[model samples]
Target: MRIVILCGGESSERDVSLASGGAVARALLERGHEVVLVDPAAETPVLAGPLHFGDVVDEFAVGKEPPSGLGRRLLQERMEGALTAGPVLGLLRDADLVFLALHGGWGEDGRLQERLREEGIRFTGADSTACTAAWHKGRGQAALGAAGLPVAERAQWQPGIEGVPQAVRLLLAAGPVVTKPVADGSSVSVHRVDSLAELERVAAETGSGGVELLVEPYLPGREFTVAVVGDRALPVVEIELSSPLFDYTAKYQTEGVSEVCPARIPADFASRLQELALRAHEALGFGAHAYSRTDFRCDAAGEPMCLEVNALPGLTATSLLPLAASGAGWTYGELIERIVDLAMS
Candidate 1:
């Protein structure tokens, strides 16, 4: 099979996406599949054929933060060429399937998925509609909670709304709160604030004219994530952070965080989390997806509280999904092959 690994959009997760794409491309190649790598934001596919995965991975192996200016520049280029497929999509059209290793905004929010659908190209992960719903924290939370899944109380905010600040202040007054971009991943801009002043500051710093915010009560407990592939949960992985919040630095920079696969929890508790994860995936219309990862934080009583679902979970070497997959006895190459098989089926 000829696979085009589409990755590295203008979103905040560009660096992680590049790593994921390189990893996935290599895995698929190891499984004897032809793989082509491309960054849609650049509008050109890597035509030199599959490079050594280690070489490509080395390029983005560093833990530095993805620059905001780079995101803006790539976003500008994306918007300018939004409707133009150029060569990247052209290459995708000829491939058996395109593995979506991209994450965050344009990649995971359904825009690129819609473009692929319009071009009649098959890709891994969820469809456009499901991706759209999953990317919106508030909407996805509401849907999952309505389906009888446990979700923390959450409020959405737009920067300039008339009563938004007051409402946000009210939410903050209660106790510690978590502030994050309403439609982002990789824990970008995710912060836990204990006071109204901190919340105000976070709002001011993260608040942009275009980006909305999702504020929720900060649930202080252990963090665990479940990866679901074709209706089956692989395993639960616990994320322990030395810092107060598991932000982008801890995730990509390999600092102050440790992940334990097959989380050290009671069997029943892990089973319940896996079940809840599947429920969240189904409720959000991602049942047919190649795979999705659901994040959770245990409350005081140890009950799992759903955070949000990742329609296209990160597949980088250090990403939780691959860790869980390994715990479930699947090698990286085997996991990639399973994902491709699921998508093609």
Candidate 2:
């Protein structure tokens, strides 16, 4: 199969996406598949051969802070015809399956998926509707809550939106609240606020930038993630963060975080987590063969609460989806092939 791996869009997660794309391209190549790497945001859409994880890893290492000015750059690129450039569309139409290694921005937020569907191109991961449903944290949480799945109390605030801050303040009254972009991944711009002053500052920053914010009661318990491939939920992976929050640095860098696969928890508890993950996936309208990763953190009562569902989770060597797959007895190459098979089917 000739697979085109799309990555490195004009998002804050561009570097992370490049790392994921390099890893996926290598794995697919090792399996004897014809792989073409494309960075839709690049001046030259088609990437050269000999993709290496180390190349991207060293060049675009995720730092302690998320990349800034990407939101504006994304808007600028779109206006300049980034994803819809003739070269990118031509490559997509020629592929048997387009593996989306994209993380945030238009790539994972349903815009790119919608374009692919309109062009009649097959791609891995969820379709446009499911991607849109899952990309927005508030929307996905609502769907999960409607499915009777446990979710942390959350509120959304946009510029000039009245009454949202009041609701967030109520949540803050209970405990510290976390503020993050309403529609983003890789924990970009995620901040933990302990007081009204800090919340106001963060809210003001987002408001000035015209970005919507989602506020939720901060859960400080054990962090775990479950990846669902096809119809089954893979083993849970526990994330031990050295920092207070699992920010971009803790996620991509090797220092501040450690992941324990098949998390050392009671069988029943792990089973419940997996069940909730699958339910969340289905509630968001994901296809039977589509894959997604659901993140959870234990609340004050020690019960896991759904955070968000990732329609196109990262595929880097350090990514939780591949780690969970390893716990389920699947090699990285096998996992990549399985996703390809599912997409082709």
Instruction: Compute the lDDT for candidate 2.
Output: 0.85
In model 2, which runs have C-alpha deviations exceeding 4 angstroms?
Answer: 50-60, 70-82, 159-164
- Write out the backbone clash pairs for model 2: none
Q: Ten consecutive residues with minimal summed lDDT in candidate 2? A: 50-59
lDDT of 2 by residue, 43-119 (tens): 77677543433333133455556567846575447424855657678878988889999888777789888988988
Candidate 1: where are CA atoms >4 Å away?
A: 43-59, 70-83, 163-166
True-structure RMSD, every candidate: 2.3, 2.6
Clashes of 2: 0
Candidate achieving the largest lDDT: 2
Q: What TM-score, to 2 decimals, does candidate 1 have? A: 0.93
Please report how far candidate 1 places residue 60 from its true position, in Å. Answer: 2.4
lDDT of each: 0.81, 0.85
Q: Which 10-residue window in model 1 sums to the lowest lDDT?
A: 51-60
TM-scores for every predicted model: 0.93, 0.93
